[model samples]
Target: MEKNQKPLLIILAFFSIYVIWGSTYLLNKIAVNELPPFMLAATRFTVAGILIFIIAMMMGKSIAISWRQLKNTIIAGFLFLSFGNGVVVWALRFVDSGFAALEVSAQPLIVLVLMRILQGKKIQLMSIVGVILGLIGIYLLVSQKQILSQENSILGMSMIFLCMLSWAYGSIFVGKADLPRNHFVNTGYQMLMAGIMLAISSLLFNETWSSPWVWSSPVQLSVLLLIVFGSIVAFTSFNYLLKVVSPEKVATSTYVNPIIALVLGWYFLEEEVTLQSIMAAVVLLTGVYFINTKRKFMVFTRFFRS
Candidate 1:
């Protein structure tokens, strides 16, 4: 943890949350095509949770938590993984993964607005501009005739939007909530609780289960990647970054995730990359940049006033 190494580690952590996490949309899209959504999600997380515990113990980390921490972890888990991630997985059944990622790029805007309402923080001029651009980008993306005309696309898009709210609020909550000191233990608890709930949800919805052995080669590989990198590595980075940086800074993963998803979807799955989508991605990520910019706005304002 030397000063030089810390910055490098932070950069590497950002890389994990950015590039690895960005690839998960395409991964989930592939896996969901062959498996039931909730069932797929249940299996991925349940196994990942178990693996996390095993790894944490092997590393000589204590996984103990008080009841209050357990309860809060469950709440955060449901908000982040169960509803936020699971519904997005479900929605991928209808919409293309790249398109879904494009829509989700507005996460910073949602987070910014939530901070304003919940914390009584005023939206600064830069963030206000970001919000306006985010809205325009979202409207352009979702309002496309081609997208809206697809069966269940609207439903899928609507559910994903709700999931974004859950994720945004969860981001805000986890930054301030009492939780386990070890990021590994905290994430392990969250994943375990979230997985159990997702398993119950899958059963309640009557989704059929199948053995991973019978899954297609591509899907099996995708699930393995989702479990190893997406759930364990990337999410751990996410939890760590939440502690080390601003929540909105951690959320900047949304900025790069869509681009990675778009290229992977188009190259691997032959998913369409429409012109409108590209335009929307540009506007959306630009707004995300504006929202994350820290102090230059105030400096510029002061200069103008002077």
Candidate 2:
């Protein structure tokens, strides 16, 4: 069992990030029908953060951090949550959904370049191919709409670019920076800090809802799912993966999420999965496979050449 532990953990981490996080898009879509975006995110993360903090304490994980560490965590929270997620949330108001998906799909590529440039990490050729393939697959998967022809289209695209950069930088920073050794503790602090910032922003902009927040079944269920799956499980898994694997590899979850999201749509919503969608999924997964499985893939290459 011990021998199988590391691979098992890696699989679990990937599953958490790829599937659970992808599912949140549907949840958020359903949720935004009732709640305003920033407030929804604020509530989700705040609640999730508190719950994770409590859980960490129960597990004997120390919740303490130095002032400097707290500062670092807050910066990460801003980058990953406040800017990365918040900007995307804001842009969705102006950007076409397909265009937004295309821009967001560039995250792995952004991370790849950032990792190479900022951290001076070397990327493998296969990984580059995989990221490109993933991007092409994503472009095919979504509607082929002209992105920048509308009013404020440039602004929307710029915000999404910032979103990708902030998220990529945050992932890299967390791996290098000294934070809470406990994953849950670190994530809890980060989420709480980001949630607070987003909530403040929402109020500063005078964002309002038509009704007082009521706990209808769908709203309650969406919030619960976001807390459990998105914040607690997927975010912690992301942090853990950043520690264990290359940040580029960790960022491959960007590509995987859309694939899982499409599958969920097909399964739950009875959405059509066209032949193009299937081909895109294959190309995307193939790219991801080559990118992450470098060593084993090298062996396969050698065998084929022989």
In order, candidate lDDTs are 0.89, 0.74
lDDT of 1 by residue, 128-193 (tens): 888889998998899888898999999999999999999999999999999998888898999999
Residue-level lDDT tens digits of model 2 in 164-250? 889988888987898887778999999999999989988987877444346578878878888898889999988877876667667
Stretches off by above 4 angstroms in model 1 are: 1-5, 296-306
- Which residue window of length 10 is worst by lDDT in model 2? 297-306
Candidate 1 Cα lDDT to native: 0.89
Q: Model 2's lDDT to the true fold?
A: 0.74
Q: Pick by lDDT: which candidate is best?
A: 1
User: TM-score winner among the candidates?
Assistant: 1
For model 2, what is the error of residue 221's alpha carbon versus the real structure, in angstroms, after optimal superposition?
1.0
